[model samples]
Target: MLDWLYDIVGRILVWIHTGLTFIGFDTDSGWAWGLSIVLLTVLMRLLMVPLFVKQMNTQRKMQDIQPKIMKLRERYKHDKERLQRESMKLYQESGTNPIMGCLPLLLQMPVFFSLFSVLRSVAEGNARYGFDEELVESARAALIFEAPIAAQFNSSPEELLELGASDPIMAKVIIAIACVLMGTTTFLTMRQSIKRSISQMPDNPMMQTQKIMMYMAPLFGLFGLMMPVGVLVYWVTSNVWTMGQQHFLYRNQPVAGAAQTKNEGNGSAKGMLSRKKVAETTPEPKEQPKIERKQPKKQSRAKRTGGGSR
Candidate 1:
């Protein structure tokens, strides 16, 4: 099933690429290819924009219902199945699905892989047999940005095979930089998403998994440099787009459940605390002592004693 999905996605990518190539967008210039990728990324995201918006709204709604969910968890503490069913019930009533928020991200992976695959195949092709050999050669060279890194390495994998590892310092450095950018952007994007979601989730095994994903994705992306510079470019561009899209989504309509509620609560608490501090710091008025009829009090005892003696 997974293979079938991948094959279908790959075909879709090829169709898009073919269309772009026919339109003179994907050409020998690296700039054209880069722009095409960017446009394609934007188009794909735009096509799913409605779904993404729905996902964000659902996430916010889920967050809003978290307190109730937590109460349910406490109520069903001993019965895992009951907890699960109750949770589903809560989501159903709220019309929010936690899983839906993940769909856009999950769908992006196949598209990303397809683009990388196309770039890799083109970059790996030999130009010896075609009438338009020069164009293919130009396309291959253009696939790898003429960065100092690409200029320094054996431009061909065949060259890489023949060259000693110690000999290609410049190429290695360039590749390393590309990999680092790809990984860093990916890590940053994941970090932002997780940071946004953390307040909504309890400290539990799931949070641990989120932490792992935040770190591991970038680490995994760092390996992309070994494939080809073109692939690295695609990965890097994709990461950048992901980050940009997320930022746009968050700024426009941030997920609101735990984080926003906590923030509002904290603000209110702070206001209360401030009022208390003012009350504490404010000085109180001192009271004056009242005078009594001291003479009457003193004379009564002495006069009474004298009268009794007389």
Candidate 2:
């Protein structure tokens, strides 16, 4: 089942390598392989844009319905099964599947593993999948500097020391930089996502899980040390793409919390403007005069008595 998938990925990589070679990138040079991997990452991300949009829509729906979900949770605190059922019903009514958010990432796994296998096979001088012996040899000889693109840090210390002696300092530096970039981008991406959701529903149970994931996701960067430099390049490029894509999505199609926050800010601004307008337009009240009518009333009574005596 996976053999076909491997063949497809291998063919794509081979095609990229061939294109690069035709464009004057030396087949045996590290730049060719690195650029091919980066191109592959770009192509893969482009293909997944639709799925990413769907994921964003799903997330937005989830955020929009968070208040209802929370109410259900509180109402059914003692009934776990009922809570689950109501949540499912709410999701159904809203035409949302929260799990859909994972589709793109899950889809990438096969390609990721397949590429890893292809690079590993080429490194070991075993041409498998759709990669021919000549292509594998070219890949094996490709170096980012003095280090082969397929080199991994999983080797023993003595072997690593030997690699250091054989390769230039720039090669090791490139790998370390890629590793750090992968980790940092992952952390930032996850953190931004978590922070956006938390801003909407701070006390949400799902937030606890997301908070845990935010820290855990970056730890995958450590595994970059064990992966081939080619794979690391691909992973890092993908991470950067994800970060940018997410930023664009959040800015354009903001989640409920972000939208609400923006609306509140606008409301406050409008309120202030209204108060200023009223102050400018409205007239102030004037004080009334204090009349003295008691002396006239006393004179009227004295005149009435003199007229009665006459």
Shift in Å, residue 224, candidate 1: 1.3
Candidate 2 stretches with Cα past 4 Å from truth are: 156-170, 267-310
- State the lDDT of candidate 1 residue by residue for 1-310, as single tens digits: 3445445543544345456778776455556545555666667777877887787788678777878987998999999999999999989999988889889878887776665555444445533222135544544544333332122233554454332223345556666788788888888988987887775455433778888988897786547655566556666776777778778888777445545786899999999999999999999878879777556444576676787464
Clashing pairs in 2: 30-143
What's the lDDT for candidate 2?
0.81
> What is candidate 2's lDDT per residue for 1-310, written digit by digit as tens?
6878878888898899899999898887778888998999899999999999998888778877888988998899999999999999999999999889899999989989988988887777787877788887777777765666777766544443443325545556667777888888888888987877676567776777788888887688789988988888888888889989988987888766567888999999999999999999998878789886656434576576777464
Question: TM per model?
Answer: 0.65, 0.81
The lDDT leader among the candidates is: 2
**How much does candidate 1 score in TM-score?**
0.65
Q: Which runs of model 1 end up more than 4 angstroms from their true locations? A: 1-26, 126-138, 147-157, 160-169, 202-205, 254-310
Compute the lDDT of residue 148 as modeled in candidate 1.
22
Clashes of each: 1, 1
